[model samples]
Target chain A: MLFSYRIMAIPSKKLAKEDGYTRLKDDFKGYLAGTVFFKNTIIHGYPHIKRIFTLEEGIKRNIKEDGFSVEEKIDGYNVRVAMVGGEVFAFTRAGKIEPYASEKLSFLKEFFKENPGIVVCGEMVGNTPFTPPTDGFDFRFYVFDFMKEKTILPFDEKQKLIKEYNLLQVPFLGKFRKSEEPWKKLREIASFLNKGKSEGMVIKALSGKEAVKYVTPNADIEDIRQNARFVFDMPVGFFNQRVFRSALFLEEFGMDVEEYKKRLGDAFYSSLLEGIKQLKKEGVVREEFRVFVEKEETWNAIYSVLKKSKEIEISDVYKWKEGNRIGVRFSKIYRKTTEKLRRFLSGYAIQD
Target chain B: MLFSYRIMAIPSKKLAKEDGYTRLKDDFKGYLAGTVFFKNTIIHGYPHIKRIFTLEEGIKRNIKEDGFSVEEKIDGYNVRVAMVGGEVFAFTRAGKIEPYASEKLSFLKEFFKENPGIVVCGEMVGNTPFTPPTDGFDFRFYVFDFMKEKTILPFDEKQKLIKEYNLLQVPFLGKFRKSEEPWKKLREIASFLNKGKSEGMVIKALSGKEAVKYVTPNADIEDIRQNARFVFDMPVGFFNQRVFRSALFLEEFGMDVEEYKKRLGDAFYSSLLEGIKQLKKEGVVREEFRVFVEKEETWNAIYSVLKKSKEIEISDVYKWKEGNRIGVRFSKIYRKTTEKLRRFLSGYAIQD
Candidate 1:
C-alpha cells in the first residue's frame, strides 16, 4: 500500500534543546522551512490536536482503515548511521557522532570489512532507567535502508544482509492497507499496544522509501484539553496557554481581540458597549454583532424583537461585568432604525 | 536598463573568521546553496582590490560585448540587519550585534516603530573594521529587503524603497544582451573599467535573479599557466612548491607522481624503466607503461598522452630513495588529499 511516511524534517538537536511550549512551534516552523509539502503518515492528537477526538481514537481509526503498519515503540535515542570510506559511524539526530559500544564497534568494523561500503539505518535500544522493562539493554540494529555510494540497495538485498550479519531489526508488525479511514486503523493499533507503559504505536507507511512517520498513541482530545487546562490552571501565568487561546480566538474572529485590547485598551470596549446601549434604547441593532456572537443569549434577545416586525428594528447590546464594572457592545440592526440609533449614540460618543 | 545584484547571503562575520581557503570554497558553496552560482568575481594580486569583471570577450574571434553597470563597492564593514521584536538590530556575519553604528540602529528602530511587524534586510557598512580593509574607512547603509510578518517584500518594491531611502547599493554593472559570445561582453566591461588601480568589473545576468558570474579584466591563460609553471619549477626538495605541484598534478591525473617517487625510490624507477624496455622488446607497450615516467622527457611524454585520453588511469606505485639506495612500493594516500598535499609541501597553508 503506497503509504507516504511523514518524516520530521527538523534536526532533533534543535527540538531537544527547546524549552517550554514554544519549542514545538519553533521546531515546526523550522520543519516547514526544510520540508517538501506532501501528505504522509502523521500522528494525530485530541482537542488541541485538532480534527480528532483523542490520540487513541485517531490511531484506532488508522488501524481500522488499515492506514499503516505499527512498529514497537522503542524507548531509546534516535541515531543515523553514515558510512564513509567503508567504515560506519553512528550520528545522533542532531548530527553528533556517538561513541560506539566497544563490542559493537568491533562488530561494525568486521561488518564493514566484509560489506565494504554501505550505510544502514537502525535504532539503538537499551535498558535505561527511563525505559520499560520489556525493552532490555540490548542494542537493536533495525536496518531500514542500505546506501552504497549513491545508490540505495534493494530491500531484499538489505534484508538478506541483515540476516546474514545477525543485525537485530525492529519487530515487523503486520501490514495494513492504506485507506481514507486512517484514523480507525490508528485507534486499533493504540488499543493493541496499550498494555505496556509505552508512549504509543508509531504508524509508519509500509513504503520503504519514505522516512517512517510515527503517530503518538497518547494524543486523545480529552487528554490534550485536560493538559491544556492543567497548564492554564498552573500557579504562574500560562503565557503559552494564553497565546494558544488567543490564536484559537483569532481564528474565529477577523480581529485579534487581544491585540485590539492591547492597542486601544478599555476605551474601545467601553465605547462599543455604550454605543450598543444607546442603539438598543433607540431600537436599532447591527448585523455584525449578531454573526460575531451568535451563541450568546444577549444576541437572541434582540433577534426576538426583530423577528416580529421590521418597523421595530431591535438593537442587541452585549454586556459583561468584570468585578463591578460592566462592559457593553452593540449589535447590527435593520437599516431604517439603525440610522436613528446612530444619531442617538453620537450624543454619548467621546471626542477623539 | 534592468540590472541584477548579487547579495551576500551569509553574514560577513561568519565568513571572516573561517579559514581562508575554506572561506573561499564556502563562499562558492554558500553562494551555490543560496541559489547563487557562477563565481564571476576576480581575485587579483592586490590583496585589497579584488574586482568583479562584468564584461565578456570571445577569444576564438576578437568580438567584445558590453557587460553590466558599475555601483560603488561600499568601504564600510559588512553587517547583516535582522529584525528582533518590532526593531531591527545589525549583526555581523558571525551573528554578533555591532555596537558602534547608531545611524543603522536608529534607522532600524524608527522603521520598526513605523512598520512594527517586519524583518528588514540591509547592510550596515560602517567605519568599523569588522573586516580589516586595505583601504580607508567609510560607512554606508544599503537596504535590501523587508520581510513583513512572514512575507518577503517583492523584489521591485525592495528596489524602489532602496532608491527612495537613498541607500548605498552594490552598483549594478549594466545589462547586456544574452549571447553565445559571453566572453565578448566580459572583455568589453574589462576594457571599459581598466583603470590602473580599480578592481575590474563583474559580468552578471541582466535578471539579477541568476547567480553572480564574473570575468577578470586581464586574465590571460598564459599568465595562469606561467603561475602554475613557476610553482612546479621549484626544486623537488622545496616542500611548499613540491606540495603545490603535487596537488596540481593530482588534480590533473588523480595520482601524486612526486609522492609516488618518494615512496618507491630510484631503484623502483630504474626497474620500472627496465620493465618498460622489456615490454617494448616483447612488442607489448601496455597503456599503464605510458603512465609511469622515469625521466623529465618521459614525464612530458606522459602529459601529452593524459591530455588526449578521456579517462586517465595510473597504477598506484612509487619509487623512493632510502638512504643512498632506491626502493619501490605503493604510497600512503593522505586522509584528506587536499590538506595533506598543502601540509606536506608548505609548512603552513594560508590562514583566515
Candidate 2:
C-alpha cells in the first residue's frame, strides 16, 4: 500500500492547469479536471495489492484462515470503467481519463447502460500503450472487480452480472482454506502461466477484503527485458526488484535455476543488444510503441495526454489508415536515457 | 568526473565528529581528519579516470592524435602511498588513510625512504577487503604512477623509479598515434585480459594528460556477481552500468554473445542465490569480510573506521591467530536490505 495511487480532489481551473490534477482540455470527457468528473459520480482508484515472494510464508502471513479466493492477476494497465452522463469512461490507475482506454471501451457502453451505479475494475490487456502485453494478445478489457460506489461487490453477484452481460472477466482460480495448501496449486498455475507468457494470480481474503499478488519468473524477467532500453529513464530499483523477484520465484517454486538463468540472461542479452544497437547506429536509446486507434482524434487525444508529462517527449509519430482504424507508430523519447547514452557513446571519459 | 569524490577540508572538532571529514580516532595514523595528515604532508586523492563504453569512438574522441600510452587497468581499489615523518600511509581514493593498506605496506618503508617527496599512486590488488581481485592474487601493490605533490611524473620517470625500487608496476601496452589504429590492439588486449580474469586497459593521452578507462566484460560481470548480495546498499547504477558495459564489450570486441549470456546468467543465479539463502536461513542480508592483519591494532583500526559510517552495522566478529598475523572475520549487516527482506518475508502486502 506504500505506493498506491491516490485519487485527486476536483480542482479549480488554475489547479487543473498547473497539473495539481489533470484536465485534458482537448478531450470533452476530461474538461472537468482529473478523474473527478462530478463530485457525485467518481470511480475510486484501486487499492494497492501487496505481493507475496514466498507462497507458503506469504499465504500464512497474508491470507485469512478461511473464505479466501484466488483470481488470475492479468498483466495489464488497471482501468476503472463506468458510464458517466450516458458516456462510458475508462480511468487509469492514477484516476486520470486515459484517452486510449476510454476510446476503446465504447462496447462496454451497453454493460454500463444495463448495470447502472456500478463500475468495472478491469485490465486493458494486450498491445495497449500502457503495458507490454504479457498476456500476448490483441487489446481487450478483462473485468477483475465490480464495484458500487467505493466498495467491491461480492464474488457471486459480480460473476452473475458478468455472465448476464457476457463480459470477459479474469479467470477464477478457486477458493481455498489455509489448511488445504493452495500454494501447491498456485505454483503449478504460475508455472503454467509462465510458459504461456501470461502473469500470476492474486489471492483475495474475502472476509478481510485484503488482496496480495504473486508473480511468475517470466513476468518479472519480461518486465526487465521490456524496459532494458529505458534503464536510464526509470527508477534504479525497477531492475533490482525484478532480479530479486526472479530469484525468489526460482527458489520458492523449486524451478530449475540453470534454465531460468539462461532465459534471464538471453532476455537481457537480446534486449540490451537492442539498446546498444540504438546507441551505435541511431545515437539514441528509446522504445518504439505502435498502436491502432479507432479514430485519428483518439491518437491525437492520447498524444496530448502523453505530451503533458513534460519530462518525456513523444517523437517519430507516423500514422497510416488501416480501413476504419488509424495505425500509428511513435516513440517516447526518454530524455535522460537518450541523452545519457549519447553522451557515453560520444567517448566522454566516465568514472564508472 | 561528475561523481568524483571530493577531498574534504580540515574541519573543526564538531565538523569532524559530524562526518564532514572522517577522523578515525582509534588509529595514530588517522588522527588527522580526511587524508590530510598536515598542510605540507597531504597525499592528494587521484583524479577520477573517465570510462569509455565503445573502443573505436572512445579512441577517436578521448585519445590524443600524436602521443598516448596504454597500460593495464588493474581491477583493485586505488591507493596513494606516501611516507610522512617515517610512517608509510596508504590513503584510499577519497583520501582517507586505509588502516589495512597502510599496515600491510611496511615492506614499502624502504621504497618510500628511497623516493621521499614522491608518492606512488598504485592499486592495492588481490584478496583484500576492498575490491574483489579480478587479477586473482594475494594482496600486493602495483605502482602505476609516481607523483610529487599533486603532479604525476611523466611515464618514463615513474617507470624508472618503480624499477629502481623493484616495485611492481602495471604492464605497459605500448604507445601509439591516432593514425596507427590503437583500438585494434586495445581490443585484442582487452580480450586477452578477459580470458585471464584480469581487466582491460586505460588509454592515457601523454600530451593531453587525460585518462579514460575501458574494461573487459569479465571485469564488469565479476563486479556485479561479487556484490550481488549488497544490491540494496549500493546505488542502483552499480548493476545497470555493469550490464551496459558487458553488452558494449560484447559488441565492441566481437565476443560470443551466447556464451557471455550464459556466464552472465549463471553469475546472477549463483550470487543472488547466496543472497536469498542468507535471507532465508539468517533472516538478514549481509557480506562477510575476512582479513589477515599483521597487528591486532590494524583490525581494530579498520573496524573503528567502518563503524563510523553510521548506516552500516559491523556484526559477527570472529578472530584467531594465524602465526603472527590475526585472521579477523566480520560482517557488514546491510540495514535496509535486512529490514526489507524481513518485512517482505513476513508477508505484509507490498504494492510493488
Candidate 3:
C-alpha cells in the first residue's frame, strides 16, 4: 500500500494526550502514526514502511546499492502483540484491540511475564477469514521484528527472543549482496515459501537505514484478485478498510480515485441494493416468529427486554403454568421493516 | 438479452433442411424464431420479448394499451424440455441439447410416452450453484409457456397440461385492464409473487397481440449483484455466456461496450492472473502426486491412454500381480506445467 508521505505525518504525544486517546487514521506509510489505549495498556502504532517499486526500477534507481537482507513477505495482516502491565493485547493495523486474537493472548502474556514491555511485530496469518490464503496452515503469529517502544531490536536480539519465547517468525530468505543479480536473488527468495510461490521479499538494509518491498508479479496479481473479489462478502468495517486499501493499491499502480470509483462503484452500490432487498424479503417472514419463555428467574428480564425493544413488538402474550412456575409465551414481530433493513445495510455499508 | 432485430431475421426452411438443424436467433419481435431438430423431433425457439420500459412508459407510449395478463418473473435459465422420438431431451435458450438436465430428462420422457411431440418451455430454477438464491427450494421446472413443435399452446391449454402432468407453472399475478391505473396494476403485480417482492411481471395480451416484461427495481438490483459477483465461480462455458450477457445488460443500461470492458475487464484479467498463479502454485506439488491403478480388464486401455496423454509422464513401469490378475505400475508425473496452466487459464478466460 502506498500513500503520499506528506499526508501521513506522525501525530505527536501532546496531541494524543489532548485528544485523550489517539484514533487510527488512514495512513499507508505503515509507519507508527499514533498511540491509543485499551484499558491501561498503550497500543503503539506499527511503523514499518516499504518502498513500492519493481526490482528493475529499484536497481535502475540505485536504491538497492546497499547490501540488504531478504525476508519472505507473508500475505497477512499487520498485528502488534505486546504485554504491558502484565496484560496481553493484540492490535490490528488499525490500532484497534482485536478480540478474536484472545486465543493467543495468554501465550503472549507468558512471554511478557518473563520480559515485559517488548512489542512483538508480526504478520497474523491463517485461521481467520480475513487473512490471505495460508496454504492449509494453522493460524499463528509470525514475528518478524521486535521492538522496545519506538526503536527496533537488532536482528540477532529479535532472533534470540523468538528462539527463547518459542515464537514463529517470518521466513527469512537470505542475506544478499548488492552485486547479486536481481532476478536470481528474487527467484531464490520466492522459493523460500509455499513451494516457490512466495508473495515477494522485504529488503531491509543491515544498517536498518531503509526497507523496501519487491513483490512478485504473481503475488501482485493474486493480491488484485483477492482484493477485488469477495469484498461484498466482508463485514462492513473490514469492507471499508479493504476498499480504502484498494484505493491505495490502485494509486500505487497509478490509477486515480475517480477511476477506481468509475470501475467498481456500481458493484458496491449494487451490493447495498441487494442487502436492502434481502432485508425486505426476510423481514416479512422473521417478524411474526413465536418465542416461548420457560419458567425461570430470568423470564421477567427477557420479557422486559422484548417489551422495551423498539424493534420488537409483542402482539400477544399468554401466561402459562409449568412445573410449579409461571411463564409467558409471546407472539412477537418486528415493529418496522426499516429495523431489519438497517441491520442488513450495516453488513454492506462502508464506514470510515 | 437484446439483439439486433434485422440480424435476427428468420432463416428459410431450405436453409434449415440443408444445415441438418437450423438454430434459433434473437428475435425481439417475440415470434417463434425458428425450429431445430434433436434426432427426429423438432424443438421450437422461445419467441418471447419484453419492451424495456416501465409500466408507465408502456402506457404513455401506448405500447401496452390493450389488456394484458401479468406473470411473476422467475430469475432462472430458460430450458425447453421435450420428447424427441420417445427419448427425453432438454434444450437451452440457444436450442442446444443440454446433457446436464438429465434429471428432468426422464420426467420429460414419461410425458413424451403419452404426448411425444409436446415441448414444455419453462425456466429451470434451483439446485444449481449459479442460479439466483432459490430460497431453499429444490431444482424445479417452472413452465411459463408451452409449445408443440412450432405452435404455442394457449394459456388455458397450457394450464391443463401442467395439471395433467403435475408440472409447475410460473405463478400468474392477475389480469390488468387498460383503463386501470398502471401503477396500481404494477403494485398489484408486485404483491402477486413471493409475498410482495416480485421480480416484476411478464404481461401478455389476452388478444395474443403483444407481450412485454416489466422488471422491478429489486430484481434489477438482484441481477446486478448476481452478474457482477460469482462470475469467476461459474463453469467456463457458462462463465463466458455470463460475461457476454453482462455486456448486453450493460448495453441495455446505455453503457457502451468500451465502458463495459473498462469497468469489468480488469476483474476478468485478475481472475486469469489468479488462476495462473494458483496453477503455478498447485502444479508444483500436484505434478509429482502418486496415483494407483488396481488390476482391471481395461489396464491395456488405461496404459494406452496414459502413454498417449501429453499431460502425464511415466517415470517407471513394472509388472504386478493384484487381485489374482496381472497389472502394471507406473510412477508418473504431469508432463508440462504449460498444460495445466492452459487448463486453469481457460476456466477464467472471458469470451465475447
Best by lDDT: 2
- The runs of at least 3 residues in candidate 1 whose Cα sits more than 4 Å from the true structure, single-residue gaps closed, are A1-69, A82-88, A101-105, A127-145, A148-158, A179-186, A204-207, A217-352, B1-352
- If both were scored by TM-score, which would come out higher, candidate 1 or candidate 2? 2
- Which TM-score value belongs to model 1? 0.23
Per-residue error (Å), model 2, residue B276: 1.7
TM-score for each candidate, following the candidate numbering: 0.23, 0.87, 0.36
Question: How high a TM-score does candidate 3 get?
Answer: 0.36
Error of 2 at B150 (Å): 2.3
Q: DockQ of each model against the real complex?
A: 0.00, 0.59, 0.01
What DockQ does candidate 3 have relative to the true complex? 0.01
**lDDT tens readout by residue for model 3, A261-312:** 4444344334333334444455431222222223353355445545655654
The C-alpha local distance difference test score for the whole of candidate 2 amounts to 0.73
- Considering only chain B, what TM-score does candidate 1 achieve? 0.36
- Local accuracy by lDDT, each model: 0.35, 0.73, 0.51
Residue B352, model 1: Cα distance from true site in angstroms = 37
Model 2 residue B152 lDDT score:
71
